[model samples]
Target: MTIQATNLGFPRIGARRELKKATEGYWSGRLEDGELKDIGRELRKRHWSLQAECGLDVIPSNDFSYYDQVLDMIAMLGAIPERFADIGDGKDLTTYFAMARGTDQAPAMEMTKWFDTNYHYIVPEFCHDQHFSLSSSKAIDEFLEARELGIHTRPVLIGPVSFLLLGKLRDEPCRPLDLLQRLLPVYRELLQRLVAAGADWVQIDEPFLAMDLDESARDAFQQAYDGLAGSGVRLLLATYFEGLRDNRHLACRLPVAGLHLDRIRGNDHLDELAAELHPDQTVSLGVVDGRNIWRSDLDATLELLEQARELLGQRPLQIAPSCSLLHVPVDLSLERHLDDELAAMLAFGRQKLEEISALARALNGQGDQARSTFEDSRRTLHARSSSDRIHNTAVAQRLAAVGPDDVVRDSSYPVRRKVQQAHLNLPGFPTTTIGSLPQTMEVRRTRAAWRRGDIDDATYRSFIERQIDHAIEFQERIGLDVLVHGEFERNDMVEYFGEKLEGFAFTDNGWVQSYGSRCVKPPIIFGDVRRPEAMTTQWLRYAQSCTRRPVKAMLTGPVTMLQWSFVRDDQPRSDTCQQIALALRDEVADLESAGARAIQVDEPALREGLPLRRADHDDYLDWATCSFRLATSVAGNSTQIHTHMCYSEFNDIMPAIAALDADVISIEASRSAMELLDAFVDFDYPNEIGPGIWDIHSPRVPSSEAMTRLLERAASVIDRDRLWVNPDCGLKTRDWPEVEQALTHLVAAARTMRESTSQRHSA
Candidate 1:
């Protein structure tokens, strides 16, 4: 039997992010649904062609999503939320995008990092009385459409167990897993339907198997696949992101004809699979690295494949990426401007496919035949080490000299808290904005015009200063205690800082999706990082000049900057992060020297960057927390160091969160109605926290009463002195009107909270 080369999934954003443009156009009423649908079709055809041309076997269909695949699964299963049921039953772009991005009438569901990766999925919402029907046949139609183009592909589906496991059940004692029995028939029917549509193999993703699962979740998996049996379509049970550590035995015993293992992440699981897997089961060995942009070491991968082949003998093994290529950029070939050495070390989706194809060829008795490819991979590995562009002796010497004292404040938290409280003279539950005002279309227009040479630096600076003045005036009118410079002159938090720092390079348009309708062009970090000069000191100084209230010296934390960028793989990630930390240290000192009293260094990506396997998280948190301290430790006790983290459950990382030792931390909690604050309460958190009083992801303007209610709920658990009032995250994605209304109520809510607290104290 020939070894099949397969991809679990591919990027759906198209080569130029045509889907983003089309979707945004449709949302703005500039493009009709017909135009948007046409773009989707063209994008799908192009992607399928690219995969086929790369010589891949078992390509995927139904992985293409206008928003998210899980949301698509939600639509396919007729699991529409109660509020959006009025949109009618169809895979209409209006209803789909509305669910992902909220309308004026309804709030969007929560979005968080999918597994351990940067890609965000709209969290599925399931009620206690959840029911299912096959409301959409886009999956089957897409599978047949690929056949029309002569590419017979496996239709992929998010398995029922994993879907409900990732969902949230509201106002109901029934957990999502309890509804699994009812949810299985929907999948069984979908599998049979795909088979009828001429798909012989269906790839059902159950990545939750890679996570720590309870007994109920494990049992649900058995019940799911058992129910899915006899559906006539051969199932390729796929899991990625990490290993099946404790779930290895359960995975082996599942009654499926084929199983796909992520060899890159769970390389240790081969022996377990060999011992426990049924001999008749086909094994799809995922050897290529999928979550990152680094080129695979083909020489090493070939050796691993040889071992796997010897172990699984005639079980019809297939070659594939460890997971989908959705997390990385679409193609490396699209890049026009990268230093030759870094380019050689990189592999986006297009290059990963080539590597997978080469791996498959080498295993099929073509080792000598792919000599050129192996030589190139080996050469890049050597060249990167010796390349002068990658290392700096001075930077290395500096890191070697850093002692533990460089990462800690001289005073303890209690001493520092007393000094900070006396210096700032702030009231209980002080209110502040999360470092940005709305980046309106006019602001973007001015920026785009400036970049295109329609205007000069003087004109741009003048416009930004005026905008900052307006922001300061608005904050003063709203009675906000701590003000921000509005971040109008910046594009992205990390990218804006990265452009000014040494040892970094950027693309003209290297856009990658952060979520639905939200794309970020992450700056690429190369060589030894350093800050030749301050990134935000001048802006912070200027904004402070406009206000008597202290304007925060806002900056992105070192761990976050490193996590968000396309970092170098030649060295340890911790080492690169340390270099970044040292650079940010210089910037922090500059801001302190520039008369900035409050500095908010945001590390929103901190929790998202933790290892998938809990066993590996300690080493990561050590360096990550150390780096954060290294960046912010230079400030005096009077200089309040504030940091912000957004999304993902922080309950697991609360110890690390406490270790960072920032004077204050603002986290995303309002979207869950402050459910996330229980971790702080349980930990007996010492520092101040702003549990984001309202959800910034939605367009709906929250009322002052709602904000007060959330504050009261948070106050029930947290000491009032320890709670700071803020929004869920930055308001950059919002419009001026929405931001204006939100902040106005936010200030009123803070005042109301303070008054009530004082009244209770007096009584």
Candidate 2:
């Protein structure tokens, strides 16, 4: 039998982010339902045609969605909360979107991080009395739609176990597994519908199995699959992100028709899993990398797949990506501005499909069709691996030379605080903000005009200076102890520096969704990284010159810069991060020399770089921590280095955070109700801490009383003198009105704290 090739999933956001614009336009009443349906149909048709062109034997359908797969599952299981069910007929497109994004009368469901990726999923809220019935058949509909186009497709759905595990407990503490018995009938119904609709294969994604699962969760997985096994549709259970360590035994014993494993991140499990596979079962060997933009080494991947085939001979091995192609951009060929050499070293979603197809063909002994492509890809991979441009001997040596003395400050916090008090003479409860003010539409228009050469440098500079002056004056009026120039000139924290630095290339339309309504175009680092000139000096110097108040010079830290960018695949990530750190070391020194007293290097993505498995996190954190020190350690003792991190769970990384030795560190704690402050209380972190006083994600302005309560809670754990009050994150996404109201309350909250402290001192 011929080995069938398949995709676990494909990109849902259409090329050019058509789905995003169309979805937003539809919600805003700019586009009619018919027009939106036409866009959706067009996108699905294009995706199916691409898969057909790549010669994938089992092309996936039902993967396309307006928002996210988790939202689709909520709709499928008829788990509509009462608040959202009253919008319209549940089948209407308006109701679907309303569930994803709230309308005037209803607030959107809460969104949370999807696994470890930046993409957010609509959290499924379940009541204690939740009942399951098959409400919608999106899988059957998409399968028949593809069949009408003469393509037989495998329908995809989140497995019953994973779906419930990802949902939330609304009314009571009910484990999602409690609803498994009730949820299984709906899955069986859906699979039977797909089987009736002429779908021979269905892909059930159980990625949560890759994580540490308790006994109840594992039993739920087996129980749910046992009920669905007789539904007539062939089952392909898929897992990604990391290897199935403890779950390997359950995975092997499952009664599914096939099992898919990610060979990129989970390569260590290949041999052991191959030995344990059931003789009658089919194994889908995911040989191509899916999460990154680097081109695959076709020769190497083919060799590995062949080895797996020999171990499980005639087990119907299929070649595919390690995960869905949603994380990567659409096509590298669309990037016209990238240099030819670097372009040759990269692959995106469209190109990765071709790689999978070619690998399958070569493994099946139809080698002639893929020979030319294989030779070309191998040569490119070898050239990159051997290129001298990837290595910086001097930077490597400097990283090695970093001793314990370099990471430590000259004195303790008490001595340093006394010295700082003598120099600046600040108030009791210091009030400052994380850098950035609102980036309005007018600012974007001006930036676009400047990029097109419609405006001169002097005109653009004047525009930026005016914004900065307004920000500085407003901060002064609000009585803030520290001021920021308002990062009006930056498009993004990391992209702004990538634009000014050498050896980096950016794309005009390379947008990856960060969260809801937020996207970032990560720059591609190709050659040896170097700072051609100072990046933030001019704007920072101008802002510092305009204000007597201490201005915090903002920079994205080295680890974050490397994490957010499409880094070079030629070298180890640790080495490349050090090169970036060395570059920032110069920028930090320049900021100090240019009359800046405090500098905040933001490392929000630092925690994200931690390994998914506990076994590998320490090594990753060691290099990551070293990289941060290499950047900030160049500054003097009096410079008051500060770093900001948000959306992080710092309980695990608290020790590494203290090791960086920043004089002050700010984190997002207001949303968590200052619970993260317990880490500081537990560790007794000597550095000054800024636990954010308000959540900046929402537009609602918090009251002074609310902010005061939060500060009081922080004061119970942290010493008042070592605390600084600030917002959770930057204000770039907010409007001026909201920003002003929020900071006004923030300053008022600080005054209340100071009054309480004074009363205690008098007593």
Name the candidate that leads on TM-score.
Answer: 1
lDDT of 2 at 468: 93
Which 10 consecutive residues of model 2 have the lowest summed lDDT?
A: 103-112
Candidate 1 lDDT, 309-417, residue by residue in tens:
8888678888999998887788877788776777888888888888888888787776675677788899988887788877889999999999989999879889999
Tell how far residue 376 is off in model 1, in angstroms.
Answer: 3.1
- Cα deviation at 682, candidate 1, in Å, is 2.2
Instruction: Indicate the residue-level lDDT of 115 in model 1.
Output: 76
User: CA lDDT, every prediction?
Assistant: 0.86, 0.83
lDDT digits (tens) for residues 1-763 of candidate 2: 5777778888867668888888778866899999988898889999999888988988898888777888888888898777877897676776777776665466566555677665667778788889878888787888889889998888899999989988866778667679888889888889888888888889999998888888999899889888898999889999998888888999988899999888877754666776777777888877777778888888877777777777787787877889888777777767877767677888888888888888888877888988877987988888788767666666567766867666455776667667777766778878899899999999999998998899999999999999999999999999999899999999999999998876677886677766544667888887667887899989889998898999989999988998788887666888778778878989999999998888998888878787777778889988888888888887876777889988766777788888777878888887556768768756978778889987777545778998999999889988899889999889998889978988999999999999999999999
Error of 2 at 331 (Å): 1.1
The C-alpha local distance difference test score for the whole of candidate 2 amounts to 0.83
For all the candidates, what are their Cα RMSDs to the real structure? 2.0, 3.1
Task: Tell me the lDDT of model 1 at 130.
Answer: 85
TM-score, one value per model:
0.96, 0.91
